[model samples]
Target: MFDIARQHLKTPRDLLRFAMSRFTEAGLFFGHGTDNAWDEAAYLIAHTLHLPIDRFDALLDARLLPSELNDALDILERRVSERVPAAYLTREAWLAGHDFYIDERVIVPRSFIAELLPDGLSPWIEHPELVHRALDLCTGSGCLAILLADAYPDAEVDAVDLSTDALDVATLNIERYGLEQRVTPIESDLWAGVAGNRYDLIVSNPPYVDAESVAALPDEYLKEPELALGSGEDGLDATRAILEQATHFLNPFGVLVVEIGHNRDVLEALYPALTFTWLDTSGGDGFVFLLTREDLVTGGL
Candidate 1:
């Protein structure tokens, strides 16, 4: 197939156009068709052949060794064949302005918590005593955990994920940022693994995608862990459990902030009297809210 590059592949962009046309012609769903196909194909090519992006762009359809060229084409064509995500194949994804490793092990970090951190959490953390301890529950790629640690340099941040494979991904991210001393990656099922840990600031972007939604998601999502996406039919299976136990695990003036996502309306309608400060931020509208211990004990406090 190395000889296929010389099969008049045309320009770099044209190659992607050709790839997209072929995938579509085959009636394959290579994601939402949002990203460029040949570009993605190029990424796979560059990765396999160990070529820089610029070099690949400048030398489109350039001759390659039989082995290297076959490898590149195989990777590109496999994505169309498997319907798996390019991110899963590449093991990299960007969130909150940084790239993190990803795979079939954990759910891709798409949590809107990125919008809640940095300058956003400041207003919600008004309590003078709420600065000491913090937790990043259900931390996937350690994305939230790293951000939390970076945000609260004065505080210790605990990052927890249920799957050991997921935790390993988180560990790679932590060490990649030289955060070995700050971010603590703990393997736990929500709060089950924490023995004597209560936090002044507890944030979780747990699995809230409902069963129907899970099944309805695009094929690429199936590459992630099912346990990390859907939490029963109503989707709050984990959230409900988290709400019931989170208060006891919070400091007196502490806060429990969970990202309920687009299902915010359902949660609000179900539990009306709770005091949840729905955060508005730069990234987008949020399902994340700050609920203090008092707020949790009292309605949604």
Candidate 2:
């Protein structure tokens, strides 16, 4: 297949078709930024050829230089043989039209909470300027922290993570966005590092993949750090801690939002007294939930 591609693949379109065929044949799992062979192939081809990913269709038939073809082929080969996600291969991931550096050091940033951040958590958050401080728990790569800084320009965001390696990557990304002053990366387990710090808003995309799901994850998912994916046997350890401790850190009238993957039912079943308001995202309402400080205090969960 390599020999045939080298001899016959001449244009971006050819590479696209070849990548699609190869990826399909390899049964590659896609979820980081794209979900299918065609999208993944186009992303890789565009990234390799130095073309805008969104402009891939415009250059499909354009001829590729020999060097360009070689680079594309190399990336495609790695995609199949290595089972690495395209985002990791390209060293970048996109969320809500924003791009951040990504690698094995941190899980690929795909938080549905990103969709709500751009709107400043509107309606719930009456005014963006009113938010003076925000917290991002389990903030791998500092993507959500950066977004929080952007959403509430006046707010100071503290991104907390347990892994030093993930904090290093988060620091790199924090510096990349020139947010050195507004976003601070903290190394601590959950809320321990930010004791006595009150915030107007708290958002988290913590480890929620259940034991069974983690055990059966695809090779691409296994490439990420297990500490960033698995929670507990039932996958609510992090969420449980967050809900229990958030009331202490939240200011009066503050809001708490969290993404729990597919554990909405399980979480609700566990905390039957709590009233969870699910937020709608591109995926659906079940993936993220919103609560107020009053709700947390009242539920006492």
Which candidate leads the pack in TM-score? 2
Write model 1 residue lDDT over 50-107, tens digit each, in one string: 7786777677656666565456556667677787777787787767777788888878
Question: Residue pairs in steric clash, candidate 2?
Answer: none
TM-score of 2: 0.98
| TM-score for each of the candidates | 0.82, 0.98
Local distance difference test, each candidate:
0.75, 0.92
Candidate 1 residue-pair clash tally: 4
What RMSD, rounded to one decimal, does every model reach?
3.7, 1.0
TM-score, prediction 1: 0.82
The true-versus-predicted C-alpha distance at residue 171 of model 2, in Å, is 0.8
Residues 97-144, model 2: lDDT tens digits: 778998899999999999898573678898899899999999999999
lDDT of 2 at 154: 98
Model 2: per-residue Cα lDDT at residue 137 = 97
